[model samples]
Target chain A: MFSGSVWKNIAVLGIVALISGITVFTVHAITKGYIIKSESRYAKRFLFQVAPNANYTNDILTDTINIPKKYFSMLGIESGEIHLVKINGKLISIIVPSIAYDGYNGKIKILVGINLDGSIVSVRVVSHKETQELGDKMEVVKSDWILNFNKKSLNNLEPKSWKVKKYGGYFDQFTGATITPSAIIKQVHETLKYYEMDKSRIIKELDVFNEIKVSNNFEGGN
Target chain B: MYIRSYKSILNNGIWEENQGLILFLGLCPLIAVSNSVVKALGLSIATMFVLLFSNITISLIKKRVSGILKIPIFIIIIATFTTIIELFMKVFMYELYILLGIFIPLIIVNGLILNRAEIFACKNSVVKSAFDGLIFGMGFSAVLITLSAVREILSVGKIFINMDLLFGSAAVDWSITIFSEGYSFLLFMLPPGAFILLGFLIALKNLIDGKVNTLSGNERSSLKKETKRVRTTGPVA
Candidate 1:
């Protein structure tokens, strides 16, 4: 159903595409396993960064609870994951990998690890599209601005005091970039509040899920 | 098609026709990632792989490609090579991959690759195109490394803080602190600093070219003697 010249063009392009596609597919297949291993290892390291001193007996990588869609919108994500950290079969903290949609340029993905008592263990910006010099100060690599969130949570400060100083709150904003820090502070506080409200339900679900999975693996082995 | 000497091609790309400095083809990553040598080197290697592979592939298929469909074919081929390089780096050099970020994928749009593909590769033999691409890619990497060194020293007061990102853990101590840790001029790390430094680099290239030309018996009048004459009588500031 094509003209002669068009057919020739299509055939040539098709051959090129097929060759390139096969090359990419082969390379991808070769690296697939390694990529998965390294990525999971990297993810584990990131978890350790968020939940410092995590002495988990269970595999934290597999011990994750996918946050329900109802709560994802509140944290600016369609879906989310809350990694469960357990030490000697007792839960210590839950790390929430969240997204802040109010960033100056675009969405800022963050990981917030909260202690059992609702205090923050650590906060890390996983990825952000903030301006290079100004807004980038929020990055822990650039400045210690993010460290200010450590050990502070909803209980320590009033709801109104959770904003950058420019907005009459405690956190310090960057010299020229106020929006980035302010947005992060606001979103982090929201994430903390979400944790507070659903703390019991989420923790209970993780515990039951872990018990069932452990029992299933035990039965399967037998 | 011009069929210049291979030695001239090498010299042209390295000095006279530098893709970065002389031609100013790819400046986005040059300015953005040149804050440190490791980041620059990461991108440099990735770009070199893409350029070399794209050139050779394009040259191989040039005769078969139709006139009207050439651009699309060239772009698709370049993008394929860039994706391969990106995926390879993501697997082996994960940290550097993260550091390079969007610039890795953005290599597809880098004018240097497409420019070389269209202008030189399409008209040349596979071997010649491969050599041209290699020389051109090296020229880009050289400029990137120099810019990175200057910026890293000026801004972070260190030469190669994260050489471990490119090299393994053994090279972690390769970083040399030039001016103590806290002593840095932030201007050199910003985007404007890139523009200023790039301007100086271009000027330096021009100055060297001028000297070389004069030494080779191509005499020109001094800048002072070539000033534009003014007809109006006024105080010359």
Candidate 2:
């Protein structure tokens, strides 16, 4: 079998593939549950950060609505979850995570929390690959530039003002990195507009999401 | 195959054949993640896991691996171990996994692991290969940690800022800020800073090596170049 024959080569390859496949499968099986837990935990952390003051009685982590492609696609993301923030058994606000694809380096993930009246409660940059000092100014830790999105909504700002100040918009883009802030502003504005257009449906979608989760859990339990 | 003493193996890995410093292997990741001590240590541990497991498996199956199928087989084995490490880190050390990002998966192509498999692990016993992997990993990590420390101190005037991400909640206060806010040498945190620091580290390693050789009265020619180079055991083409 150690002979350098074509058949031996194939046999060795087959054995290697089988072993590697089994090893990978074992690891994936062992870590799948914990990985899912960490991901949901991370999402919940962002939820709390975006709407820190929202007195949500329910577990906002579990209460999620999947954004439809028509709305999410414009923001350069394939899909996203709208985490509903409920207070005193009543819906108060929603936290929406969106991606700005035109960012200078790449995609910039932003989470926007909007109040029941459609005004923004807060905005947080969950993740981005922007330039460290310049584009990273979008991060709350780096600068107060991100706070500009707070308390502002589509109704307050004219549609034309969605662009950065360099483009005659209200928001101030970082001095060296205009593309990142401009892209974020444009996409955040669009996300707000999309929410406004389907406000009723988006809110009602939460009930549907809850029902689906309940049924899925019931099916899995059986 | 000639069996070298364990002490010689350790010396070879740590000082003589250090993948990061001596051979200048894996410079890309060495600089990329070495900006922060915790991040470098996290990646180093991940690489160690991959190397250890890949070396053992490759050694165990070395006899069965035909000459023609060696490269593809080694690659599959290395990739499988890398995936295993990545998955484990994502589960237990989720924060570090996210911080290290693509570099975790990119460990398969680090060239260090594959080169070890082709050169040392494939020809050695399982125990020897495992030891080699561990020592080589430590050697590389030493360089990574040193470079990261230099960069972290110079760039931000802080040391161990986020130990909790790698350690735990109890280690949250491990961060040491040498300077207060509003002051930082920002250039050292950037890519160019990484290059400068790495250049100094490589030079330091060479200088030490040269001093040690001269003190021992050993001519450079006494060191076998063949021993330093990894001969190809893969497909000739």
Candidate 3:
């Protein structure tokens, strides 16, 4: 025969289990909608920042890109390296975010947004755990030092011009944070080098910019 | 199964078995994203969702589950709930998810969940155990959020509630600015800040516990004497 108390214990536990399960499920289901919205907004912001200054106002997350599974071998599609910018219907530019290896602390995460014609739109610091005032001052948010790297093409930046003011480059190092600024300039040089070498491949892959097609023309076209 | 008393519910969650501050569970996510208040809040809330459901599901099935296979069953239940939360996190709070990264899935390993399944859910009735799970989860999350808030405020010299973020648009700009632009204290937001704050908080809790016990000690002497007499009498000839 079963133990004297086993049945009683079972009844209590059974009720407890059912109630707990139902309540928790209820809360989770209720909050699911809010959580989804938050995630989409976050991804949208990053997508815009990481891509380019286009009105990429698609229902972004739901908007699927029909990328080939074998996209790995595609040309100008540098995998994790493509930036997309569009203006007036035609694709204006596509810059791949790359790194400059000579950062003072280490390699800085740089997202260099460029146009098809080799003109730079912007370079943002994706991340840098460098020192404050000096090293971390290299951030575009912290100072205009990063802005100086804009527009200057491969031919314009001479190797000797790569140094900071302290090191003789046009860029000024922070009054006390020379290592930080110098590192950024060095990164800028390397970023340009990467872009020069891989521009076509990167642009070809980020088809996010290709929205114009002559589909569904009216039968009464003038 | 019923809330026969209020004190038991509070005590169960607060400390006798705290999720993180005492049990040392979920330390990985607790330490990593705790660099700022906002980051910590996002993670804390996300974790609460996972813990709440997993506890309930595990408790419901405790009777049917084999004692030997209880551990794996607990894991599957916890994993399914965690995955649901993960998908929700990715779709809605993508920024928090990206920042949280591996730590989100690591919730599967949070001793807090396992401990709840092994200790509370499997034994207690559904209603009682669900409250226990919530209370414990909240207590642990409360500690995490508070610690991260302290660290963030000191390090950055600001509190960005971004209420619209976790709450909704209504809470946007709800953040109270404690210190002006230049007042930010950098050290508090770093890794060292976490250890320093954790150590101080532990010391503070211990001190309070000691003080409260001392104040109540006189009334407990008679009870202690009875227990002491039983202990001392047992082994004596």
Candidate 4:
């Protein structure tokens, strides 16, 4: 029986805490695998949105190239991944995940899929903390503003034309929300420039890695 | 202390002592997540699950716990259940898990859950406490869903939009557009709108209660008998 003594009360509290800790630990253990899978599935869903399923024959989710920390400044993200789109062993495009930290509210995460020819295949806002109704117009579900990025590249537009229309540029900004669109456009432009500069190096690295992987598979079979 | 009847407990939770409407507990999440129905529904279900389990656990251990240590123990139990629900949602309902975000973890601090554990669960039978938690949670959900429905419709001119976030892909078409494109009223999507709409809802509830009371008053007079009033304060009679 639990007594009115101080020690007994402490003991009861300790036991309750222990039981709760165990319960939570058990639940976490059971759900950990599924949680990771679901998270990756969510990330993959956005990747496919930027790089449509019809364009790529490879498993783009697994075919990601982790961007080195040194290139974080160029991508405007702390860390990033670029999913490769390949067909019959030939790399044709890549989806670059970029973040714009100057969103009206906070950072806006976007995925830009670009062809090897440097034109954009498509662009999708993966996540954002921008104001609702005004800044959220960038979403494909809400408006076609994001779709305007399709087929656009640095070559088609002069450096000045890349800014939102409010700032004498090609893209239209929401009536009350220039900051969010401007941030996204700047980040997308920067990501393209990063790709342009590093394209050859990334391809050479991928080719070498692929050759090693193929050789390892051959040896494993033998 | 006297034991409350099952019916009275249910009535107390659902209407007479509704947490959101009357008690006005847990208003933080009530205002924040109620901008959309799916988000409101997600938080409601998560809160209800925690409430039910925590109530049951508290009632079961009430006799063993001393007075001073009761609050901490109840909190630990509630937090444990909240974390468990968060993990479960992450695994199964990943989209909703992402949508609900911080509000799911914030369930531990919801005054409604802790209040029930302290006042009702600690003094009642486990079954009665569990039933109380269920009805109380339903009462809270009723207010949240209503508030969110009004907010969603007024702001976006749509109902059930993005139901798939909570109900999965099969519910993708469940949304119904009430107004044509570009007919949205932005005020209703903001937090200030929630406060104003919630005020109107409370007024409507009071009006309904007044009407019901008058109708019951006539019946009582005809019988010339004193009916037992639903106790809103003090020990159950």
Winning model by lDDT: 4
CAPRI level of candidate 2: medium
Measured with C-alpha atoms, the lDDT of residue A158 in candidate 2 is 91
For every model in order, what is the number of clashing pairs?
A: 0, 0, 21, 0
Please identify model 1 stretches exceeding 4 Å from their true place. A1-4, A52-54, A101-105, A131-138, A141-145, A153-183, A210-222, B184-187, B218-237
- lDDT of residue A203 for candidate 2: 62
Of candidate 3 chain B, the 10-residue stretch with the lowest lDDT total is B1-10
lDDT of 4 by residue, A88-115 (tens): 7788889988899988888798999998
Which candidate has the highest DockQ of all?
4
Instruction: Say what the RMSD of model 4 is.
Output: 5.6
Q: Write the per-residue lDDT of candidate 2 for residues B2-87, one digit (tens) a residue.
A: 46778988998898889987787888899899888899999999899989989998899888775768899889988998898888
Clashing pairs in 4: none
Residue-wise C-alpha lDDT for candidate 1, range A21-129, written one tens digit per residue? 9988998899888888877876776678877584668787787877877888788887767888888877889888788887889899899989989899899998887
Give the lowest summed-lDDT range of ten residues in model 1 chain A: A51-60
Q: Tell me, by TM-score, which candidate is best.
A: 4
Comparing candidate 1 with candidate 3, which one achieves the higher DockQ? 1
- State candidate 3's TM-score: 0.72
Q: What is the lDDT of residue B211 in candidate 1?
A: 81
Judge candidate 2 at residue B119 and give its lDDT: 89
- How far in Å is the alpha carbon of B150 misplaced in model 4? 0.4
Q: lDDT by residue for model 3 over A1-222, one digit each (tens)?
A: 788566755665465556546754775787778876775665445345544555744443343323233432322123453434455544565544455445566556666656566666666676666754346665655567666767766677687788787777777777666766666666666656666666565555444344223322333353
Write candidate 3's Cα lDDT for B1-237 as tens digits: 333344776785786556666777877777777766667778777677777777777777767775545786677677767776776776566665666778888888888888877877787777767777778788888888878878767776667544455566667676676777655455665667687887787778778888888888967987899999999999994
